[model samples]
Target chain A: MSIKLTIMDEMARVAREHGKILAPLDDDLALLDCGLDSLGIAVLVARLEDKLGLDPFTTAEEVQFPVTVGDFVKAYEHGAH
Target chain B: MSTALTDAQPLRARLTGATADAVFFDRAARVRVADLVCRTSLCGGRADLGGRAVLLVTASQLTAALALIELDGMVRRLLILPPDVDPDHLGALIAGAEIDAVVTDGTLPPQLAGLPVRVVCTPGIVPLAEPPRACERTEWVLLTSGTTGVPKMVAHSVAGLTAALAPSASAEPVVWGTFYDIRRYGGLQIFLRAVLGGASLVLSSAGEPVAEHLARLARHGVTHLSGTPSHWRRALMSPEIGRIAPRYVRLSGEIADQAILDALRAAFPRADIGHAYASTEAGVVFAVDDGRAGFPARFLNGARNGVEIKIVDGCLRIRSPGAALRYVGGAKTAALHDGDGFVDSGDMVERQGDRYVFVGRQGGIINVGGLKVHPEEVEAVINRHPRVRMSLVRAKRSPFTGALVVADIVLTAPAAAAGNEAELRDDILKLCRGALPRHKVPAAISFVPALAVAATGKLARRGV
Candidate 1:
């Protein structure tokens, strides 16, 4: 799957788990950030690994910027490649 | 006079004993067993105080017996110990204090032989008499700022120490856990609470792995755990605590951050997470809700259990039921309180609502061009970053900032994925710049696999 699709799916999973409306790809992941503290990221990262063969952002540092959903997706896609 | 068995009961039994006068079992059974082993091995040739007095050198069994014997009226007087304590110093103290008899373990230096001293290895050997009259003026001395700088001998009294612990809203049996040695004030409170409140006590083994200690707590059904921020962080990092939840986690002996407190609360949702400010010189003065971490403490508004608090010179002082007494064998210093006898240990405060919050120790504040920077404030920001797991903040001599703040951090395992130390450092610095104020930002950041803590499992102030 493409990195964009993978990122979108992962964000959707987080949104579903947190019971929040999913934001657009270009929107910030504020909905997930509500519950996506460090531990939440660990869960998200694990899900990303299962869906996409390539992992995004070699470390937690890559996912540091959650300012917008698009930024998270771009970062993840860049890392997965 | 009470005999051996009565002195050996569990803390609960002891607390309930006065009313029940029932069978008592000393909770420190291991120490008693060790003493028995020693007696059997030595063929009982050691000095036996029998019913006279026992001197304790450490809070361990050998010394615990001394405490018990003195309490039970088996001994006329008791002497607790500080390791490598000088005999001449103790002799002079006893002479000045006019204490006649001293019962101790047989490990005293030769110079102490002149005094009437009995060596006791077990609490069973010491007989008990009527409890001594509550000292109208008793002092419990704490030797803090040891050797690193001019060591100050701080003195508080039995009444003062007891007065320091404000009553808690929760009456459920208090479960106490700490890495601190009972010799210090922080750990001493746990001992006192367990003994006085008849609470269950789970003593963390010295030098045990944080994972192992958390596992031990689960196995023992511990409900309350207390430690410094470093200790709690380590325990949280352990997979065991993530699975094993306690009812209460208290951070004391140092400052804490919201991130750590939030993490702990999530890990143990049923637990009430809180922190308190205490020192060897001043007993526990204030406590705040778990959410109050990273901020200055909100002092208890109304006196609880006869505890009192006041801020003097921007320093928070407390007088509680569990405060300590005066110093002995060290330079005589004034007690912790002011004229009203309220204990103040030089903790800086910020008034928040009706209650006061502790910002930092007065001497511990770092002046960056007159912009006061508390290391804990900066450290809280550093610890909030996702990459950072644990950190220590201390002031360094800097020509530019006068006293520059430095953050030494231990990155989380995932943070190490950033490739190199430089990458992690940049990430941490960037986070600090974005989250903290310009002045509060750390002047220098050092990344390490772990931060060094003291023997008592507290972050060393120097951040060595």
Candidate 2:
């Protein structure tokens, strides 16, 4: 699976576990509007860290805050380089 | 007047009794207290280790207990060396504590090759031609597990060490057991409880399995049990925990969360469960026995038997005769007390309505963003999960918030194998979400087989 799918799957899983009804996973969908809070985002990052064997937020030099789902996925994809 | 006990008198006078029964035990030997009052030596022949600074590095805690009973007022200073002290720093400890003589189990580590005067302490007694004469006073020097470098050595008078211990409440012979080595402060408190409180004590052996230790405690009819919450958590997880029926259970060295307290209550329905607030430097501050987590606010009332307490900027400060006099050799972080004589315990506390809840230590804070989270605080919430056995919350370096809270948790045996661990994780996370603020809640938790508890019987709060 591409890193984007993996991130999307984990986001859905974490949101489901948190009982948050996530908005449609459009690239332009704002992360805050996806019904996930900081804790959910944290869990998503942690699950990604486990599955991907890396935490882009920790590894990337001065990674920007992801305002949208596409930005979050791009950060991880950029780190994969 | 309390006969055979008061700390003001010499241990030679205190251990004198008509009883022939053994008062201390280990995996190998049993020793009587009153018998030690008479002229004798465990090292064979006469040991001239009196009226001078003495280093007690006995391999066996039983032997250490014996040394303590025999040399209380007979030595100018008695320094207890726990098994975990850095050998490289042994020479420094020797000079810092003014240790001139050594007592050991004949296996002195290479660190002590410099000390010429040595007495080998084994199990059996040697017929003594004459007992070592008593000194005017003996200062008990205990090494505090300092933050870094060589541990700081603190001096305590016999009265100071025993001031927190209550007199024998009754003559009933309740054999005591602890999961602590008799060298550290927590262990020494139990040692003093057994000896001065007029009770038999079964000592813990290092590396012994929880089941085996519990069985041994059962074999000896251990009724009063004491240890840190970490020790008790490990013991409670063992199937053999049911083997021993204790009348009293005590926790110290770490904050006793409501989860462990409630678990202990369920495990031993009839046992009197209590936890105390004490430190290596501050001695014992107080004990709470109401089957509660934090202590009642009333403990802050007027002086209770000369022990004064005040909270200065969220830290608990205690002033008592039981507090250690001063740190020997002026090691860094050895500012033992303020000019007002209050030893500032670095333990942080928060007032919760009518109770004082211990948050965590001053230096143990985990910063998440701009907010502070105590690992113990996060762990206390996670441990409340029904399937959780124990948890260790810690910090993970995070580019997002400088540092993020993470937890390594051990689940109950059944839950571990049930294989629905994902659900348990979600359940635990939900618990954290409910009880904790966003920053204090763990960002993630990893299921672990076990958490490492240090020799100090505390959850080793280091990187996972």
Candidate 3:
């Protein structure tokens, strides 16, 4: 099943906060790279942790993913269970 | 930062008093609090508890309380664990060790649903409890392997530890920064030195952001920074290194070379970049800083008798005041021991005139077939280049060669400058071939923007 739109919105909010423009979720998520640096990704993960109340990404490799907003939402949704 | 007067009078006086209330743990205000803890523990009835009565809380407030316990003579044992440790493991360890009373934030270990030890959850309440006396020497125990493998308890004495701290040179007030776990010995030294000197301790919010850490140094006006060679290299590569500066930079827990020293000097022109040599078992050995990259002649030409260092069988042997009593259960015995007292660290060394330089750990020297290849030796060659910021050389399994040297590099310049992966590969290979020995040269190179540095700013060599 696909992720909820609310997750996409929150992901977008995080991307925007990190000074990245998020493409629409309808597009291929992998195509839209937000170019989030380490600190930016850290902020995104922290926000997601607070929002989801779960530590989704612990390792550096996991955090390096979600190059784009759509990719982030998808990853979060996939791991939501 | 500021050595402002505490709300109370001088700490020595309160420590001497029958009843004294003071802040026990503070990352920022360590020296004052440590001094207070040391004084009170020594004078008060609790002096005997040494490591046992002391309930070491991971939180700054709890650490403060533990410091007070250390002073009050109430602490009979010390349970050293990081704030982030698994509560289940902590409780199990505490229970297995039979900790008398726990001084924690009432955060019960998941495994410790119900324990017999009295729990002191609040700092406000710790002071109110009847003054617990000091614990016995046999009670001083530290977690065996840390987060790795199974955890065991290693016992130490207060006099042994106090003796450990006393032999080292007195620390001057400086900002103490590190990337190692606070629970680990490496991290504890930084904490100990800061508490001893009362310096501001700047912890990394973002793990080892060398640039960000340097900025924090500027923000907090931190004077002293400590870490492994890898950490120092990160700080050197940090764009902020050229921008902000620290007063003193110390490299420890690993071998440091000229390349790292040169890079740090380039980054912090005004700072005193040096080496602080020590081990987990050996508390604080002699530190070598020649105001340049290589080792110095015992700081002042073997002037201090507290630490005596020599090279035997091409290995570094040292006897110092801060050396540990003995390893509890480790296979390795007193390294390079003379009949009388001195201990060898099982590390090879090269003598360049008076100063002795560390070559590599005896255990780590990789045997590629028969030729011995030290990882640091290969790393130093690669790191000498201006574009290469950091390099980790490790032996990789190879079907043809048995084991070939592999280097993972982080560049100071953009990766695209080499045009593409193939070209970058060729260029680096050519550079290594021309500069290094056949066996010493890396067979494979992976250009990464940054290498994975552990929290204590040391290179993570295991997974790589």
Q: Taking the tens digit of each residue's C-alpha lDDT, what string does model 1 give over B111-167? A: 556656444454344322322322212234444634253344555444455555445
TM-score of 3: 0.65
Give the native contact fraction of candidate 1. Answer: 0.00
* Ten-residue stretch with the least lDDT total in model 2 chain B: B1-10
Two-chain DockQ for model 2: 0.40
Number of the predicted model whose TM-score against the real structure is largest? 2
Instruction: For residues B1-464, write the lDDT of model 2, one tens digit per residue.
Output: 11243338876666654245647888878877666766454564234665778899977898888778777876788899998888898989998887888888757888787886787776676555666555547889998876468888888988888888887675667688989888999899998887776678898665677888899899999989999999999999888998998999999989999999999999999989999888889999888899989988888887877888989999989998889988887574557889898999988999999998999888999877668888888888898988889999998877556678889999887545467877777788888988887777777779989899988888887842
**Candidate structures ordered by TM-score, highest first:** 2, 1, 3
lDDT of each: 0.56, 0.82, 0.55
**Candidate numbers, best DockQ first, in rank order:** 2, 1, 3
- By TM-score, is 2 or 3 better? 2
Put the candidates in lDDT order, highest first. Answer: 2, 1, 3
Q: Judged by lDDT relative to the true structure, which candidate is superior, 2 or 3?
A: 2
Query: Candidate 3, residues A1-81: lDDT per residue as tens digits?
Result: 244565555556555544566655544545335444443344445445546755345533434344545566666676777
